[model samples]
Target: MFFRKTVPVALLAASVFAISTPMALAAGKGEMFMGQFTTEHGTTSHPMGDVHARLNPTTHELTYSIHWSGLTGDVNAAHFHGPAAADQEAGVLVPIDGPYTSPLKGKVQLDSQQAAELEAGQVYVNLHTQAYPNGEARAQLIKH
Candidate 1:
């Protein structure tokens, strides 16, 4: 009887501690942001897609998923361009891994500045193709 009671109490204490630990140790979790990619939104008009991304400030990781279609030709490259406002242009900030195909999923480790840019809605994902070397489809990342 004593062993049974002590075991149950210890387990209950352990369970309670585990549950509360995460909350107390929680870091600054960021928000999930999304964007609709389209040709008109880009510098050209040929490709379209959607982008979903989130920046985890605690880990300094940016996770992204993209689905694209209607690309004029084979995808040549894709990247996250940054520090540009909507309808404006900027340089590439992060190069996405290629053989670029639809429903792409990837993660990138971002620095403090990049995380700040992402939170500020200054980052955009752009897809480049044979026809449009600049950008075929683009979308501005916005915090939701």
Candidate 2:
């Protein structure tokens, strides 16, 4: 009787583990990426800004929040520029449409290539202002 019960319980536990392992693997873990914007990182001079973002690997969804103060002038645009290093420049990969105000928050769906670049730490955030059309502040997004 002891042997019979032990064998069945062990088999049940093994079955459950096998079933759940794939589900957990498929769900994956959420990845975090963050950056701090500074005039030193950009082509022109301006005040500081910050960005925090999360990427859901399973869904390919990216959610972000940004805050800034003391810019040279009003912000006109912002973007995630990528496939480049912190010291390098690249065309915009994702444009941040906005009322151009502070404490910006939004979400976007990233393609596989964009997601891969972001995970590889080749992406950066940029905020553009009237005083600095190229970009007022910039920061490289580092994965955490």
Candidate 3:
């Protein structure tokens, strides 16, 4: 009877400890923030498919990935729009992968400050193709 009671208690304690461990760990336990957007040229409505950004918690460095099949015309510029929500106005936060042509690929590197915004969920990713030339896709960065 004594052995049975002690074993059960020990197991319960171990289980509780395991459950709490992930939350307490901060170094390698950072999260990924993600979002996406897309647009075509000469159209007020920008809706293609979506784009994504995978960000590292500790470094703030980011890898931007975009794929909006519906985007057309051409792109002019792409940037990080900030401090706002979708359809809620626009703010300049940082820059995306860039110096784009067309038939774009989905990858770019962000600097330190841009990475900081990414961790804070304040930054957004924008893409411009030769067709749109202004901005064809956009996605906000948020902890995922």
C-alpha TM-score for every candidate: 0.81, 0.77, 0.54
Ranking by TM-score: 1, 2, 3
RMSD of each: 3.4, 3.4, 6.1
Candidate number that wins on TM-score, 2 or 3: 2
Give the better candidate number (1 or 2) by lDDT. 2
- Candidate 1 has a TM-score of 0.81
lDDT score for residue 17 of model 3: 94
The residue-by-residue lDDT of candidate 2 on 1-144, one tens digit each, is 999999999999999999999989767667999998878434445477788999988787889999998788888999989899988899999998798788999988889999999999999888887768888888789998
The per-model lDDT (C-alpha) reads 0.84, 0.86, 0.60
- Top candidate (lDDT): 2
In model 2, the Cα lDDT at residue 132 comes to: 83
Regions more than 4 Å wrong, model 2: 1-28, 40-46
Regions of model 3 farther than 4 Å from truth: 1-30, 38-46, 99-120, 129-134
Which portions of model 1 miss their true places by more than 4 Å?
Answer: 1-11, 14-16, 19-30, 40-46
Q: After aligning candidate 3 to the native by TM-score, how far in Å is the CA of 6 from where it should be?
A: 30
Candidates sorted on lDDT, descending: 2, 1, 3
Supply the TM-score for candidate 3: 0.54
Model 2 poorest 10 in a row by lDDT: 40-49
